[model samples]
Target: MNYIKKTDAYDIYIEPSRKTIVIRQKWKYIWSVASGLPNWSYLEKKAWHQKADNVIWLQWGSHFVFWALVHDENNSNVSLHKKEFNLEFDIQWVTTDQHWTANVKKIGASEDFGSKVNPSDKKIYLAHTDVKRRIVSNINQNTVKHEFGHTIAVNDEYGKLNGNYYDPIYVNDTKALMNVGNELRARYIRDIKIKVNKMIPGVTFATFLDK
Candidate 1:
């Protein structure tokens, strides 16, 4: 019956012997309006649902079990299981018709369009332009998974710090999800498990997988 205080960050609370750990995620989708575009209601709904689908793809291929429930302002009554780990995301969509600079504040305004997790607020932000680009390039799911990985404290596999790669282990792993535009890889799963184990006390990926 151990309980961990939930902060503005992802937190896990579980019994030492519990084999299955469910990660519950809540998502909020926002879209900016553009002139001459399709109806805002329809476009927003489609984008929001597509984001949910992309996140589900991540959960299905990852090592841990996640019960991700995404909701917009309209549909918020979906049943979500009570779980040990939880994450929240604010996904924003900026239409192509609007200038990027004009909407930077709403798009999370970073030099890198890479998504980030705000541990202080327990929220992840994904830029609209980044999403649209990935969608056009047919790599939306991969980008989605990469951003989600950051929520669990996983470092960018392709990122550099002080001229050194964050995780040299993944330097050559072109298919590592944490790497730029890469697919899911077993090593990425293992990396996530290691990070999660360190974050949550008495909960290990081994136990979850064994279940």
Candidate 2:
């Protein structure tokens, strides 16, 4: 539960008019040392997002999760996926040895719903593999962006479903990316811009939001 330091630079940039934003990210797939590395391409493909303008690009050496997993010589109390930008996995074969299961889990207190976002910390935790799989299958999909929505302080519209208090505006709007669908609505974009503006001052999102 790392809080976002006021001094920390914003990790996201938004352009409300064009409805696009860029999120900086890093990733790591932790497997048993016995398990050889999985194909990076397959992982990348699964994690690819199909959104037309939104992007979540990987930034090397910046994935705190990967670093903690690899460097936990003492196996210290490392909270996976529950902390900032951390995604942890335990490798397992699916149908065959060649096939790998992307089993993801959260390492902290249980919530009425699933997944969480700490805007101050700029982190999104996908609590279940089903959610993670969906996200990896299409990284730029609404689910991924929905979590990104949390990183920017966007409140959840759906209540129990996503572990937050209910909000009618998001729940009734299926097209709203922050709710429970794949479409990215204009309102969500505008909401995000407003939130980002308040969270991070003195930054201009390239005219990407204008279009």
Candidate 1 per-residue lDDT, tens place, 1-211, comes to 4434333323344332352333334444444533444444666667655764456444443344533232332433222222333222322233432111112112333334545655444455555543433542323344555666665556777656447667776766644667665554444345334444554433333423211
As a whole number from 0 to 100, the lDDT of residue 76 in candidate 2 is 34
Cα-based RMSD of the predictions, in order? 11.8, 16.6
Model 2: residue 80 alpha-carbon error in angstroms: 43
Candidate 2, residues 135-198, lDDT tens digits: the string is: 3322334344466555434677655552547676556765455666555443434533444445
Which candidate number maximizes lDDT?
1
Off by over 4 Å in 2: 1-9, 12-113, 127-142, 159-164, 191-211
Instruction: Give the worst 10-residue stretch by lDDT in candidate 1.
Output: 97-106
Counting only residues 3 or more apart in sequence or on different chains, how many pairs clash (N, Cα, C under 3 Å) in candidate 2? 11
Best by TM-score: 1
Give the CA lDDT, 0 to 100, for residue 151 in model 1.
56
Query: How many clashes does each candidate structure show, in the order listed?
Result: 1, 11
